[model samples]
Target: MLNVVALMGRLVADPELRHTPQGLSVTTFTIAVDRSYARPGEQRQADFIDIVCWRGTADFVCKYFQKGSMIAIDGSIQTRTYQDKNGNNRKAFEIVANNVHFAGAKNANGNTGGGYANAQPEYTREAPPAAAPSFAIGNNDDFSVIDDEGEDLPF
Candidate 1:
């Protein structure tokens, strides 16, 4: 009854944007997701996944995303069947993206250039100092963990 998926990967190529007869926008793209494990002496493998975005999401992707852009996707897996040109039935699988996020690295100018001119972060320094750690190493009265008697913590 529950269906959900999350992926972080780089775009295989620029998304193909198109309009339906009803004038609705749609965009299709592929992302290369690398596998976490590989056999010894073998290189890591990657799987190219197809993604579909509709309307506002499609427009945002076409305007901002480009080939090789790293992206995070939150959506659900969809499967459908169609006949290929060879007159054989085929099954297609893709993600129906509810949200697509920017995942590319920030460049030297502190910009994440995913085809769109990047925006600068609030802490705009050449290099920021390391942040201080919050937790105490030894016992500290202020940071005591209360046991919940094997019950989930109340929200």
Candidate 2:
């Protein structure tokens, strides 16, 4: 009975925001989700998924997220049917987002947009491990070598 879909991917283009007659906000965008598996010697494939958000989520996306921004979306699949130009019925599938999150690295300006309602600190990458302390004995005045004490020492 679960119809939830969760995906993390990069946006293919800026989200398009629209307003309904009643003044409800809506945004539609596509994201490129890379396939998990690829054949040897072949490039990995990506699926362009259509996503839809309503009201506040739509406004948040338009205010921050942009093309090529990585995002995590949690939603349910929805299919709607409409008539094409030739009067043929067409069905389109999309995710109706209940949650939107930012997942990309910070830019040079140090902004990761936002996750959910605002930027989630959990998305930030950890700093690289610090370099190990130097242990070599240099030719400094502080080092003194003793040979008669029978004390084993590491140089």
Question: Highest lDDT: which candidate?
Answer: 2
lDDT of every predicted structure (CA atoms): 0.87, 0.88
How does residue 9 of candidate 2 score in lDDT?
97
Return the number of clashes found in candidate 2.
0
Show where candidate 2 strays beyond 4 Å.
Answer: 113-155
Q: 1-155, model 2: which lDDT tens digit per residue?
A: 99999999999998889999999999999999999999999999999999999999999888889888999999999999999999999999999999998788877666675433344455678999999987677747776876866656654
Question: Which regions of candidate 1 deviate over 4 angstroms?
Answer: 108-110, 113-117, 124-155
Clashing residue pairs in all predictions, respectively, total 0, 0
Residue-level lDDT tens digits of model 1 in 1-155: 98899999989888878999999999999999999999999999999999999999999998888888889999999999999999999999999999988888876665563645445436545876799878767858777787778668676
Kindly report the root-mean-square deviation of model 1 from the true structure over all alpha carbons. 11.4
Angstrom error at residue 128, model 1: 12
Q: Assess candidate 1 and give its lDDT.
A: 0.87
